[model samples]
Target: MNFDLQGRVAVVTGGASGIGLAVSRAAADQDMAVAVLDNNAQAVEAATAELQDRGFKCLGLVVDVTESESVARAVADVEASLGSIDALVACAGISQNTPVVDMSDEEWDRLVAVNQRGVFTVAREIGRRMVARGSGAMVVIGSTDTIGGHINHAAYAATKHAVAGFVQSAAIEWGRAGVRINVVAPGAVDTPLLRTKFDDETAQRVLLYNVPMGRLSRPAEQANASLFLLSDAASYVTGTTLCVDGGLTTGFFYNDQVH
Candidate 1:
């Protein structure tokens, strides 16, 4: 399928590392001028430098996605550098594994701020511009928890559920403006974030036991899904979620034969 993203401009939050970094590289690989945004200023520079070394056009920015002013400024900077925005991949997010009963209100708020509010802030600012131009596409970084329940994932899952709802509603509102909105929900992606879920090796092993693929997804695999959603090839796909999990959300059983 043709991505048709050449010469376009895209903003990828959390693009400094992990899956966001992969998506940023993939967009640049497709000839899109990329704006890599993240709270970590140093990582942003490293990421942009890496892309530049690869001969890809890219800009790195320090952005706090939870703040509307910060997001607006970042978007303005991206447009100033690369021209009008053509796509957005809202991949800035974090994970927490505390049980619901033990989670503090502050922790809950922090999760909501980054996972839910951050997505809304970026999408709203970008969507407004896209609506005015009457053309654009966006892909939010949702998680497998968006559709299924998980133990010790109360706060994280709640925020993702909110993001999922926002995407659906925004899709309805933005469809008429030629702006497509969708989500890519990944399960057990092999990113630094995944390793933070457990304190010991045994817990990680048990978690992966149920995955039918028997391994976490690669960052590029998840990025490919987002790239498709942000491209012309997905013209008819909107207000939907593409799960890039290793079949963890669908259904999985132990092979019993693995030793």
Candidate 2:
């Protein structure tokens, strides 16, 4: 699949590291001018510098996705610097593990703000630009936990569910205007975030038992899916959630065999 994204402009939130970083690199590799929006100012600069060193046209901005003002400013900056935004990969998110009953209001709010509101903020802002130009694509990063119920992930799961709703509604409203909205739900990916899930032994065992692939995903693998969704290759695909999980949500297994 020749995903020729050359000459395109992409804005990726949380593009400093992990899956977001990988997506930025992938887009740049395809000859797209990328603007990475991230909260971590230092990391964002470093990531941008690394990409530039590799001869990719890239820029980095510090923006808190949860804040509308920040998001708006970041989008405006990217547009001013990189021309019209051709694609948006909303990868800004946070996760926490807490029993539903014990989850604090602050924690819940933070998760929802970053995961759900962040997606809306970036997508809405970028979507407006795309609508004006009459062309654009958006690829949101959701999680398989949204499908497979997991323990102590109420906030995260709820936010991911909201992401699906956002994508669907946006697709319906914007498809006529040539803006495509989609999502990529990854299973277990070996990123800094996943590492915070548990200790080495428990995390390894859990991933092994749940994922038929017997390992966590690489950031590049997840980025590949996002790139495809944002590229012309998926021009016909919209209002959908594509699972990049390693068969984790496909079916249940009993003694390593599907029932």
Candidate 3:
């Protein structure tokens, strides 16, 4: 299916690795000029090089999405180097699996800063540009935690909920301005972050047992959903949350025992 994204520009936060990198590669495959933004300089360099070697138009920038000034600079740089941002995929985030009683204040703050505030900062900066131009699309990467509460994931779940809320509110506010904002909540995907939680084969098997698909998701699967939302094919869609979780959040599976 043609996404009709050729020659457009896309900014993908956390584009150096995981689902963000998947999004970057997918965007580039659609012939879009991709700006790969992440906090890790080395990863950014490597990702950019790989894309360039593949003959894709891409730029890599190390950005702290939690800081507005940093985001503003990255946005400006992207526009200066590529063009006006036509789409944004806010994918930079952090996660932890700590029970409410054992979670530290610093861990809570850190997750909020990166996952919640970081998504907001990048979206706000880029969303403003989209609004000013009177046209754009955005997809914020959320999690299944946004819907179902998980064990030892109080903080992570809360931040995801915040992201969903933010997307709905922003979509409503910017709908008239020609800016569409939405969330793509992914379930268990094979990423470094997921490895932290399900490190061993036994843990992974347990996780798969809960998912109806009987397996974990691939990064490309999440990217496919995100790119669809960013494309004109979903022009009429807004203020929605698309769960690409292989039916993991169908509420039929028990999660309490997994953790």
Who wins the lDDT comparison?
3
Ten contiguous residues minimizing lDDT sum, candidate 1: 250-259
Stretches off by above 4 angstroms in model 2 are 196-200, 253-259
- Which model is ahead, 1 or 3, in terms of lDDT? 3
Candidate 1 off by > 4 Å: 196-204, 252-259
* lDDT of each candidate versus the true structure: 0.88, 0.88, 0.91
Regions of model 3 farther than 4 Å from truth: 196-200
Candidate 3 has its poorest 10 consecutive residues by lDDT at 250-259
Q: Which prediction has the highest TM-score against the true structure?
A: 3
| lDDT digits (tens) for residues 167-220 of candidate 2 | 999999999899999989998788887786656676666665767777778999
The estimated TM-scores of all candidates read 0.93, 0.94, 0.96
| 1 against 2, candidate with superior lDDT | 1
